[model samples]
Target: MNYLKEYNELTAICPKTYIKYSEPMENHTFIQTGGIADIYIKPKHINDVQKIIRYAKMNEIPLTVLGFGTNVIIRDKGIRGIVMNLEYLNDITVNENEIIAGCGASIIDVSRTALKHSLSGLEFACGIPGSVGGALVMNAGAYGGEISYVLKNAKAITLSGDILVLNESEFEFGYRKSIFQKENYIILEATFQLINSDPAEIREKMDTFTALREEKQPLEYPSCGSVFKRPPNHFAGKLISDSGLQGTRVGGAEVSKKHAGFIVNVNHATSTDYLMLIQHVKETVKQNFDINLETEVKIIGEE
Candidate 1:
């Protein structure tokens, strides 16, 4: 793809410090295996983001949005047109019982802030590895709690550069899904409603959750957390384990020995390795239990 014209137009919108051509996806993703993006930029502010959206739309460039490089797999062929990494928009503020954070703010940071303010709602996110926008978009949850419980509202921008604010009801949250998934909108910020609690108690709860994650998850290896979602009445990990697929390896990608839920980069794993392992696990589990396993991780980019 010829990106020279688009590059010039986008560069005019933001400083050179925020723009790059052919940025490596390996450097941004958690699993660390993918090709380069034709154009990548980190918008320093929301206005800059709006400018880029307008520019991309005006130029007819395919635009992709990235958060903190967690919970996604970009293919070997990488991405075309423009890719915007929202990491620079990291900002968090607390006003009484509400905590407001930018799309790029790390969930860990948000959880820490919650602990500082003796907030109880974000305890479920202490161990989550993605950004605020990602958590809201995927309806991320753990330890019997999910984002839908605390998220009061979210602000997002559309493909055509129109900004919209969605309340809880419009969020359409349901088991790892939000309206953001169904619409082409880029999340800008999220407001979470938390309750007052003893700081000591909040800290204890966070510590317990962290310990559990360490014990059950394959934290030692680079991975895209859980590979599949929980089936209607059964757990994905238990299903894979029951099928004797734990510790299974394909290229460098393996169903984690520590937890069958995660597919880890045990060696020099490529995106293809991860994809193959996922397909193999799905097929194997389907044949064994007559139930199809659906992936929870979002896979994107070209082949």
Candidate 2:
């Protein structure tokens, strides 16, 4: 494929935007194990985002949108066509008890910003390692707090270049889902409604959560945060740990002894190795407990 020519055409339309051809998905993903993306883009402005979408639509190119790559896995054959990463669009601002943040802004950073402003609602997000956009899409939460609880509204651009502002009710938030997953809308920004609190109290809560994450999770390795979603009345980690699947290895990928919920890349683990280990864990857990395990991580691209 003459990806350079396509890159040239894309560059012509989305001028000054950073674009690359045959970019390695491993470098962009948190797991660091995937093939190449045909074209990778980082748009600096919302205008560029609109232009890229229009170009991709007109050319019939497959467009894959990526956040900060914290909780996703890209397959070995990589993603074809254009992959847009909303990294440079990050910007955060605070107004009294409300926070207005770009979709690309780090959720962790946003939480910190809340603490700095003495906001209490985002303390649950203190340890989340995803973009605000991705967190909202999946309704990411921990320690009894979810994005849906604090979200006011969100700004999104449709595939047809139409802008829409959706309120909290329209999000359809659930355990780990929102309308964004089913709709072809590109999230632009989000507004959060928070409560004013003592900076000391917020910091104490943030510190506690951070300490707990470090103690319980395998923070010293490369892996998607948590591999499986919690079952109806059972915890995925407890099931895997009880099934004696900890420290199990598939190639360089291993189920972390520290947290059975996480599959870590202890060595040069490929996407295949990671995936195979996940399957093994699921099957073993299902066989032992008669419960099916669904993944929390978003797996994309080709096989």
Candidate 3:
């Protein structure tokens, strides 16, 4: 494609710090079920990200940002445009009882850092399989704690190429949603406020949460963590379980027996298979419970 040619030319002129022409979305996502991206770029620094965004905007080329890919599903037809990966932006620093983390930094890393510093609030994120940026954008949560509770502020690049810092209130975080969902902003970093606690106690809390996840989740399979958002006053998993959709399969994708909330790639599932399963689950739940199940996982690219 001409776009691929343009992407190559641009990467050739860019600094060596960034890597260009990566691979399939499956390689990056937790579910391992997506097609290839035409042109994948990994920006080593924040400036590199800005430059790439400018280039794409100037040329009217499509651009998509990928974090750790824990909560996203790229389509089987593959992504047509530049896929910007911020994996190299991973950086974390702790001051007092707060943490400053780059968007690319893993949530697991942030939680471990908090544990090292005896910070208590982030223990709930230790088991979450996402990067800081993805968590912030989705307001990712587990075990009753969420990003909005601890996030102080965030730095993001606007679609028009302006960098802005927004406080937690400005993001308007609510139940697996954030302002980033509405605005085409690229998150750069976030700061979080934590609480002082004993190191041993923090470790114990993290361990308990991790153990709970291990016992309850299908950690053995490749899958997006939670397929559906929790419906009002009710759990998505309970609804699916009540609908008799547990262990349901479409191709190699199946509703996880261990956790009804997850749709796992049990045996080399294609992206189409996974998506079909997701649709079936949603339809079944709606038909049986009369509650519409919204997806927590972001679906991207074409069919």
Candidate 4:
């Protein structure tokens, strides 16, 4: 395929879209690791996203949707085709007791928006670092709250460029799983149902949660947050700590000594290092506890 020709066409479709050829994924991901993406785009408008999606489908080009890259690990060999980073789509607004956030809006920012509006329900997400899209994909939660508890509906685009509005019932939310994970749909925005609360009370809750995160989580280094899902009746971090896997290293990737759930990139780690360490953690935990740990973070791209 003539990538230059495709790039020019995409630019034409969305002249203001930030487009790059042979873009480095390492620069985009929070882990600061991964190989290159063939074509990278950060579309500024929702219309641009639709147009790009249609163009890719018409051209039979593969497209990958990306959020803030907080809970994902791209392989070292990198991804082929188009990688669309939705960061530029971030927009947050409040209406009555509801908040509408663009898919690319930071979950933390969304929670803050809730607070600004004196809205309750998103206090649990005050410290989550992923984008709204990522949170919806994983049904992300913390401190006794999850996305399913508050999400009313979401706007999305099909792979074929058709738009959709999925209500909460249609979300099919589970433990860190949502329909978006099973379907070829790109989340565009979300509406969250919340309740009016005292701003001071909401801020207090947010402060408490944020403080707990800082005290318990490893925030010093770059890492994909929480490598594995919570096993039934067991916490992944607790299990890893019990199995004595913390501080275990594969190259620069080490199971965080601070938080056993995280594998930190302490020394310019490659995706291979992260994956190997993850595999090691899973194997050791399975051997010791007979609990098969499933990864929570999304791993994509070639080997």
Which of the two candidates, 1 or 3, achieves a greater lDDT against the reference? 1
lDDT of 4: 0.92
lDDT of 3 by residue, 1-303 (tens): 546577667677565755546467788889897887878888887777888888888878889999988888999888887888887888999999889999999999999999888898998899998889999889888887999999999999976678999996699888888998778788999999999999999898888999999999999999988988888999999999989988999999999999999999989998899889888988988888899999988999876
Q: For every candidate structure, what is the RMSD over all alpha carbons to the true structure, in angstroms?
A: 1.0, 0.9, 1.3, 1.1
Backbone clash tally (model 4): 0
Write one digit per residue (lDDT tens) for candidate 4, span 118-195.
899999999999999999999999999999999999999999889999996699889988898889679999999999
TM-score of each: 0.98, 0.98, 0.96, 0.97
Model 4 residue 211 distance off true place after TM-score fit, in angstroms: 1.0
Q: What is the Cα-based lDDT of residue 277 in candidate 4?
A: 94
Off by over 4 Å in 3: none
TM-score quality measure for candidate 2? 0.98
Q: What are the lDDT scores of the predictions, listed in order?
A: 0.91, 0.92, 0.87, 0.92
Worst 10 residues of 3 by lDDT: 13-22
2 against 4, candidate with superior TM-score = 2
Which pairs clash in model 4? none
Clashing residue pairs, backbone N/CA/C < 3 A, model 3 = none
